[model samples]
Target chain A: MYGLIGKMRAARGQRDAVMDVLRETTGALPGCLSYVIAIDPVDADAIWVTEVWTDQASHKASLQLPEVQAAIAKARPFIAGFEFQVETRPVGGFGLPTAEPG
Target chain B: MYGLIGKMRAARGQRDAVMDVLRETTGALPGCLSYVIAIDPVDADAIWVTEVWTDQASHKASLQLPEVQAAIAKARPFIAGFEFQVETRPVGGFGLPTAEPG
Candidate 1:
């Protein structure tokens, strides 16, 4: 599976607002296995997003969706900056129900 | 539950080597729900690690374990640098089987 691990820094205390948009925006994409948004315990202004998709193409396609675009537009104002964006190939784990068949 | 999302840059083409160490090191710590390591698709020298634990204390305590400390020491040589480390409070999601009671 394809995975994305990244962090977004929100403006001042706007982290929750941005997280709301992210949670609302990430509707059921075709290949989405998991989409989790969490508040940074140490950095109050940071939000960490972890996503698991069936493949890289699915993740790319989701970005072009209208909802995603709208969400980006909505959250853009609160975003201070992005940090540590990395792509990954997920193997397997406890809560990963979408384990692809080999 | 507590979560950690971060990226580690490996030295030159040592990403895979570093990943191996990570996988080997993260062996069933108490309260550790998940520990996944993935390579950065775009960056050849980067690795992304996503971890979910029962609580912040568990994660902190794990770090002090002999095995964990040994793993860190073993992996340190290949680590180029760290980027985008964030602590998170996970709500709920698929594949995240360790969802705590509300």
Candidate 2:
């Protein structure tokens, strides 16, 4: 599986607002295994978004989805900056659902 | 549960070696729910370590464990630097075992 680990900084005091948009918009996406949104305890304006998709192609395809595109448009204004973004290969985990081979 | 999303940079060409140490050493820890280590596709020397613990106290306690200390000591040599570290609050997700209330 493919994974994305990244940090997004929200405009001052806007982290919760950004997270709400993320939660509301990430309802259903084809090939999405998991999409976790977390609050950064140390940096109030920072949030961590970790995603797992069936494959790189699935992840790439998600960007073109109307809902995803809308989400990006809606949340972009609150985003101040990004700290780091990394791609990963996920082996297996407890709560993650299995994905069909790509 | 408490979560940690962070990036660690290994010495040049040492990413795999560092991941091996992390996988070998993180066998069991009190209250540890998940510990995922992934390589950055774009940066060969960078690795993302995402952890989920039952609680803040449990996470703090882990640092004092002998095995954890040993693992840190063993892995420290290959560590080049940290990119970003963020603490998170995880509500729920697939594959993750439910953590007991703290």
Candidate 3:
């Protein structure tokens, strides 16, 4: 499985605007299985988006679409900058031998 | 399962310091099963932490411990602010019914 997470900042007063677009767009991504856009309850300005994709290549392909591009463009001005982190691993499902505390 | 995510900003140049403490402390939390601290590769000032705890009670109890308090005190100055988002759900497992794209 491949996961892509983006941590971004929304322009002052624009966080909800970006999330609205994201909610509208994510459900349609061809390879997106699970996607979450979580806003920090304490910091109204922070946003963290998590996406679980089938694979890295599929994810890269979706990023090329016109809609995706447009969404990014619309949201870019509101964003100060963002960090993208990607990880791929064989997740044997959740609760897999819960790690014992030391 | 109870999951708590905190998105915080590190004071200029103190990101590493906070992460260092988190890494050291998480392993000892009696109820912590999985903990991940991901730094935005694009935004050096942002940090997102994801933790899976056995339950809320267990998690709350840990916060009261002396070591945890000290760590929080030491890191507080380095934090600009943070938002906490908590969710509890029976996460049956991962990769469940990979959602189909519309």
- What is the C-alpha local distance difference test score of each model? 0.77, 0.77, 0.61
lDDT of 3 by residue, B1-102 (tens): 555655678998898887777656665477765455556566676676655566678889989998889889888888877754444321322322222222
Better of 2 and 3 by DockQ: 2
Q: How would you encode candidate 2's per-residue C-alpha lDDT over B20-69 as one tens digit per residue?
A: 78777665578877776667777788888778888989999989988879
Candidate 2 segments exceeding 4 Å error: A73-84, A90-102, B81-83, B91-102
DockQ, Cα level, model 2: 0.26
Q: lDDT, candidate 2, residue B82?
A: 97
Looking at model 2, the pairs that clash are A94-B95, A95-B94, A95-B95, A95-B96, A96-B94, A96-B95
Scored against the true structure, residue A34 in model 3 reaches a CA lDDT of 50
Q: Which stretches of candidate 1 lie over 4 Å from their true place?
A: A9-29, A42-45, A61-85, A91-95, A98-102, B100-102
Fnat, one value per model = 0.45, 0.31, 0.02
Candidate 3 has which clashing residue pairs, if any? Answer: A11-A78, A83-B42, A94-B94
TM-scores of the candidates in the order shown: 0.70, 0.73, 0.50
lDDT of 3: 0.61
Candidate 2 positional error at A15, Å: 2.6
Candidate 2, position A86, lDDT:
72
CA RMSD, predictions in order: 4.1, 4.6, 8.9
Candidate 1 vs candidate 2: which has greater TM-score?
Answer: 2
Model 2 chain B: which ten-residue window has the lowest total lDDT?
Answer: B93-102
